[model samples]
Target: MRLKERTIAIVLGGGKGTRLYPLTMDRAKPAVPFAGKYRLVDIPISNCINSGIRQIYILTQFNSASLHNHISNTYIFDTFSNGFVEILAAEQTNQTDTWYQGTADAVRKNLKHFHDQNADYYIILSGDQLYRMDLKDMLDRHIACGAELTIATKPISREQATGLGIIGCDSEGIITKFYEKPANDLDISEYKVADSLLHASLGKHVDASNEYLASMGIYIFNAKTMEEVLNNDKTDFGKEIIPDVIKQRKVATYLFDGFWEDIGTIKAFYETNLDLASINPQFNFYNEMMPIYTHRRHLPATKVNFCNISSSLTSEGSIITNAYIVNSIIGVRTIIESGASLDGVYCMGASFYETEVEKTANAKKGIPNIGIGRGTIIRKAIIDQNARIGDGCRIGIDDIPRQEGDFAMYSIHDGIIVINKNAVIKNGTVM
Candidate 1:
């Protein structure tokens, strides 16, 4: 049972990832790079493709140029196939003259696009999330139970439920209550899902410690239900739309016991990246069945002359000479000079290399070429794409430095020490 022809996935690239700070400084959150080889948007998009849901629409309003470029360059379907990865950028027209105000508003404005496709059901996805799910299975359950709306939910601890879209369902997997990030003291006794329902929903995959279900922000709606529900003035989903329809509609929850993380904030993003470097990573990049796709750089294998890299991922076209990198992700086209030490860092390598003439000009201006400098020590930091690290410089807790102010042209995020894209650093600098 495939929903390929009847389902069209809509991936919402949420407005400028304000929580992600420097990473979102110049690009949309979904466009932000992840796991050394792919962008955050690739997760949901890849999931859609792997599930045979190839007709994807990405909606973005903030810094969408980069996102557009990535999508355009990467996804190209054959002439006979109707499959495509298109971007519906927010626009102003005679009907309206404003940007997308919220999630519901964004889709409300673009309803015409989906209406033309006439898909029976629409799957809504978050572009900046990390997970792999088969929509066919979830849709199978949704259709079997005749649910008007279905939410993909994961079991979470009581403490973790306080900051998410908390769900409460009955014994038959039918939702009875929806709480959008309830306060710690909020009473939720009557809304809690029955233990039998949860155990039956997951069966052998049940976790005894998971007492609450948290929404993954992935919603599947019947086409008519979408039209009737979104034809309102509501601006958001978690805040307005879901709450308004739960009682009047047949809502249900689909249990997902996979590794899912919302990479919305800087801390969450940093932690998630570092987790990829763990020995037994929760989210493995080497999944052959459902591999995450990305724009191919077509570069050669990385060259390490005398560097020591352990539990780290180094992408293509990187050159590390006599350096030590531990538990980090070195992005594509990175060049780490001799004697540098990096620990728990995510270095988003340069997008392109500088020509010899460009390097000479950069040297004249006393700026380091796009990579870590000789003898530089960095730990627990994120180096954005095309960043330069000067020689003999120390970053991230080397001198017990908590200063977050810009060092040269770099920006800091909650002491994570981020060097923004295409920024430069001077020699012997410490932060």
Candidate 2:
């Protein structure tokens, strides 16, 4: 059978994104908006589609309404193609009534749904990540090595290894050991990559700082091997299944040299979004060969009138007038009134446009409309969907040191102010 026909991809929709709070307050981690228009889940799904692997299933649990809607509207396969992008949500059954305990458990519960796929290999992916990779290469390596399990690993420095699962591999690329998040005092020098392995992967001598191999949480398993490993009650792959299988099975590692960032925390998400507006970003979403796909709103073109914007990405259906925006992402349906200024901000625009009557009514009630008001100045902040920033407001631009915690209508995380969805910031407010 062909590679596309014999492989199935299962994307794990992450648990309640507590770290990405307010953003995840109303949606699943995978459903959270990304870049200017795409969702976090779109990255992996688009990678699958671009790589000719359309037999995809997303496993979701928490706040999956928006996720389900997005998948249904975005990824639709024709009957002739026999390709599909399906969702396998957590449900109650005779076997169990509890939610997904962990990553492994989520797949284990849905094994019955995948029994009819007849795929030779199952590729597991994380939904909340940013990277573009041809998964075919990893599967090819797995077949060439005759390995039951192949893990995608990234070379990282010692400083980056503290919070990630580190793997130890021999010269032949066989994983010898696995350590999950070793502490500062722990001696994991033995797990460092050998010079021979580093040269084989990168084709050059890399600095000793990038010695450790951190698991990218991307895995491909032989169909039978996946069943065998999930027979137990192991809840997590990185913590339990992977470490146990390395000893009993042939587990290999595939080195990924491309840029990959785990959008786990709010700070990481913020920085990653802002980086996309740079002159040259590490992760390019503009690749024609493997373009990232998302919901097609078919909205009108953005209307920028007398705006001094620099190095920013503005999506469709936006109207900016006499504003100064720099190094920011203006999302769909955004409206920036005259005299507004934004710097290093990600404004997730309104979901639905308000009519003139509605805006007038809101104004009479002393409420800001669903957009950035005139004379507002926001810096280093995330304006969520449908947020109403009143006139003359100053957010994140003040020199006052704000503690990292949730406040009324907004929160401070890593020095970035995040205005909640549909939050109403009164006029002349300063933060």
Candidate 3:
């Protein structure tokens, strides 16, 4: 089938991110606020639209309202054309009366919808990733190679390759060995070092230059292949589906040598946002052409008071009160209280003023009713909307080394904190 004639691509947005606790408490992983103003879901959908694939169906389960609302408002399908982007929420069908079990299971449950659309191919993707790729390129490669399935692969460090579905492909790009999160071993050959401090500077201990390819959780499957697998599946694509197909030796590797960051973990999620603040961003969000689309909050220009602001993205409706903000991302309607200091923080909209002052005071005494706090300093922290911080709390914990604890925390490769929405920190507490 030609790439343009492909039926539709299914984006899996149903994962109830338990890992991103406080943030996923009220919204799905895809709906979680990211960078300064956008949600995690925007990356994939924007990629799809820009890649010339408009017929999309997002599979959703937990906290689907926010996801649904965002998709509807931001992505209005063209009325004149047959192509459309839609959301497939869980419903009680005749074949099943339960919620989706996993990634593969979710699609299997909704096979009836796909049948109605009559798509020629199925492009399956993960919603929780930060990358800019041309999907059309992958589709073209898949068709040209005449393969039943084409999986996306990217090179990663051996130490960071543990949790991924690693693969060893032959010279012709046919995958030879497949391991889902293999144990540490000297089984594979390493790459030669350039010896320069820039290339080989992870200390001499990083001797092995093994070029292991990790699955980016993106796939292009023929419709027949999808139907066959889904009809005979009880497991997910990552854990069971892909591995099972690869075992048949019919899957080909589509090597994606480009910038890709998986926001599946807390740490990765935090680091991706901070990367946007860098002087030369790894991912450029400001690209007017082929821009990453998000629901425009239509917020007025951020009001700045007597504050020291530098290298930050302060979205509309954010009020910088006599505070100092450096290398941070503040979302819509966010008010940084007087005397507060924000460094390397991603803050969303929320304030104690949303509710009765006494109600907020009961939870965290001395916290400002206006929102955020006075004399509070945040470093490498993620603050969700409407969280009230007391007068003297330090939001980010970069000063001290990273620590694992009871309060739900998400950190990326680089040590950065991910604060989810509506998360309350008790007054005087240091995270």
Candidate 4:
């Protein structure tokens, strides 16, 4: 299929990210620093650029300064004269009087820019996901099928399908039935039946019951379809818009059987990062054939000492001393204290636990001292940027339930906890 004329994409980066808790408490969801080196926004933006789609716009809302700054500094390149990235912050015009309410509304609020550019296709993606997809292929399929809207679909586990936007399609890959979250098991089963109409394996169709698919929240909208839907909607793209459009429009489904993960929650975010550190990760970001682009901060290669480290992606200037890091990621300019222990953890850029904390209270809730006497041990945790850990603190290792104190404690879906920046703890505190 021939490429559509002048395609433009808008990445939604405005979510508050409350599920990420303390880490996102200060920044927007997309601006949240992730996996030691890059922000959450980097993944989607990188995906867009790598997929050969430029002229991208990132929509931002809460704490957009850091997100905007990172995008401007990192994503600016001189390769293409016509390629550029822009941020569309939530603002009120003389007509409307509030911040963006939802994803559809955000796009609707900025309809003028999209219309002015006269883009034929509008690709919409969330910034809080960790998946690498060649949107060009999806766009090709969309054009070939003459679809008003094309959605990226991925097969998901039956038990886990309840949380996502479940979809159903016809034999020609035209979506027919769509549900945000179906309640009854029989209805979900029926939805799966409807999905089977389009997703048959050509030579194999009997085992189609196991072939359940859900929307990835990635959409390619034919300009006219987008103009009509957003112009007539008040709810979100999935919850309100797409469900109604599929009934009246020629909506198609693009099947993708690769690794696609939504890292919207703390547990999912943490687990996906650890997945990158696996010996044979399900999601291979290091694939030389399809590497995920970043801001390209130039620094020296990481130095590994007698530390037992493996399967982890270490950015530049990360000094791993006589510590044990397994299946974890270390970000740029990070200094791992000597004799520290880490496993299945994600340490953001330049984080160092302070060596000073008054042991006035029982070794609990607050930051734990991180020296030899403090005895720090971390397991399945995420330490945000520039955090200083004291001498002796145990995180996720010992079976100590988190307690409330001066420092905050957040539990993600994968049980990976988050430590805020510059949080001070006394000696021998248990997390």
Poorest 10 consecutive residues by lDDT, candidate 3: 192-201
| Candidate 4: count of backbone clashes, pairs at least 3 residues apart or interchain | 18
> Which digits, one per residue and each the tens of the lDDT, describe model 4 over residues 359-381?
34424555433322223678887
lDDT of 3 at 190: 33
- Candidates' lDDT values, in order? 0.88, 0.93, 0.74, 0.75
Superposed on all Cα atoms, model 2 deviates from the true structure by an RMSD in Å of: 1.3
- Per-residue alpha-carbon lDDT of candidate 1 for residues 53-147, written as tens digits (9 for 90 to 100): 98899999888889999999998888776889989999989999988899989889999888878799999999888999998889998999999
Tens digit per residue, CA lDDT, model 2, 221-294 = 99999999999999999999999999999999999888999988899999999999999999998889999999
Error of 3 at 130 (Å): 0.4
For candidate 3, lDDT tens digit of each residue in 30-62? 888888678888888888888888788899888
TM-score of 3: 0.85
Best by lDDT: 2
User: Worst 10-residue stretch by lDDT in candidate 4?
Assistant: 366-375
